[model samples]
Target: MGDDLPPDLARLRVLETWAAHYLTRIRARIAAVERQQAQQQTPAPTAAPPSRPGTGPGRARTPDWGLAEAGIGVPTTEIHRGDCWARGKTLVPVSAERARAELADGTQPCAVCRPDRVLNRLGSS
Candidate 1:
């Protein structure tokens, strides 16, 4: 019985040693992965430039020359690039022909860009 106990104890010690080695290897692999992730991380932008007006997310500074209908069901109006003062309005892009047609259909051209002048140029050309 004493002899059997020594063999069992030896086996238990071997298992413990194997588990420790496995755990050490796992920890080393995890550390290596963490270091790699850190190296791959992009550095934060240094001294971001001052944001321009109307340049925030989902806001267009220079929108395409087109007709814009207010998302809140306002009448569709001719809008020029960079001239819309109405915030939270979704502007849909249209062609010059469409702009002219829209104006003829009672859609007002943007007072700022004067898209009517563009329509006149298109007519002359």
Candidate 2:
């Protein structure tokens, strides 16, 4: 075949072969990079065991009256600093004095923290 072909045609054939080989390698590298990027974007699976009560990661701290709120001002239930076991409730931090006043105005204390007793002690002096 090389004997039948002109030199320029032979040279062109060789260049085309080289170009095809180079393009194939480039495409493979692009695919590898895309795969890497996809792996990076995927979220890792969380295989951590469920947290144990008062002993594992993210255990609930003891509830305190350091901060108080009335469940976003609806007065349904008051909240203190720690977890209240109430769902879908928002807390608005207030001063201890304001918390006492809210308690006086019939806002129920948080069942978890018992802010009523805490405020009573605060009011005592």
Candidate 3:
């Protein structure tokens, strides 16, 4: 094939190959540029509120000390088994189910232990 072509024509074939390779490279570059532009135009996620300091993994929110609206204190002792509040008035070790129900009904936790603090805080208007 080389023998069939003049030196100038052989040089032109090499230039053509170079141009093809350059075009492919340019196409890939353009695709990458398009992807970057698309990403820049898209919106980012909104940041969440920062959490409070000094709270531990098992530690929950502070429960309200106020009496239940029913005028009867939910047996807090059932929740915190060993812990009692203010001269046996409150109890710890609430059952998960009861807690959930109370929470669903907008009940709060014992102010002393605060096991139901999360529900109370959420339920409060």
Candidate 4:
């Protein structure tokens, strides 16, 4: 009589509200900790290498060679340095030698990253 909705349904709704509030609090706490971590960390004094674009806080150390794909049912379009700012539809890891060979075989080089520079720096080493 007092409540318009059924008792069980009302309880479920109450629990759902509580769960959402709890999740919000948990996410806030996690974000606070992440902010603290970012504040505490400092850049290195030595000359360090560049980081990948989306790896987090400019501290990534994962760079190699990769082939950028156009899309499904399409061929790879360009070669990219792992840390290239310009991203393709997809990337497939490959060896430096393979990248060099692919570049030699008419695969387009990424204009932004210029991966070919790394491959041909030594001039046949």
Candidate 4: C-alpha RMSD after superposition: 14.4
Q: By lDDT, who's the top model here?
A: 4
lDDT against the true structure, each candidate: 0.61, 0.58, 0.48, 0.71
Q: Tens digit of lDDT per residue, candidate 2, span 32-113? A: 7877987889656779864443455564534334344433323355546444333123456566787787777877676555
Count backbone clashes in candidate 2.
0
TM-score, one value per model: 0.39, 0.36, 0.29, 0.47
TM-score of 1: 0.39
Residue-level error in angstroms, candidate 2, position 86: 3.8
lDDT of 1 by residue, 47-116 (tens): 9875665587996665546566643333344555534443124567676677777778877776546778
Q: Write the per-residue lDDT of candidate 4 for residues 95-117, one digit (tens) a residue.
A: 88889999999998877689888
Order the candidate numbers by lDDT, best to worst: 4, 1, 2, 3
Q: After superposition, how far is residue 5 of candidate 1 from its true place, in Å?
A: 88
> Candidate 3: misplaced stretches above 4 Å?
1-7, 43-125
lDDT accuracy of residue 79 in candidate 3: 32
Q: What order do candidates take by TM-score, descending?
A: 4, 1, 2, 3
Query: Among these predicted structures, which one has the highest TM-score?
Result: 4
RMSD (Cα, Å) for all candidates, in order, is: 26.2, 26.5, 29.6, 14.4
RMSD of 2: 26.5
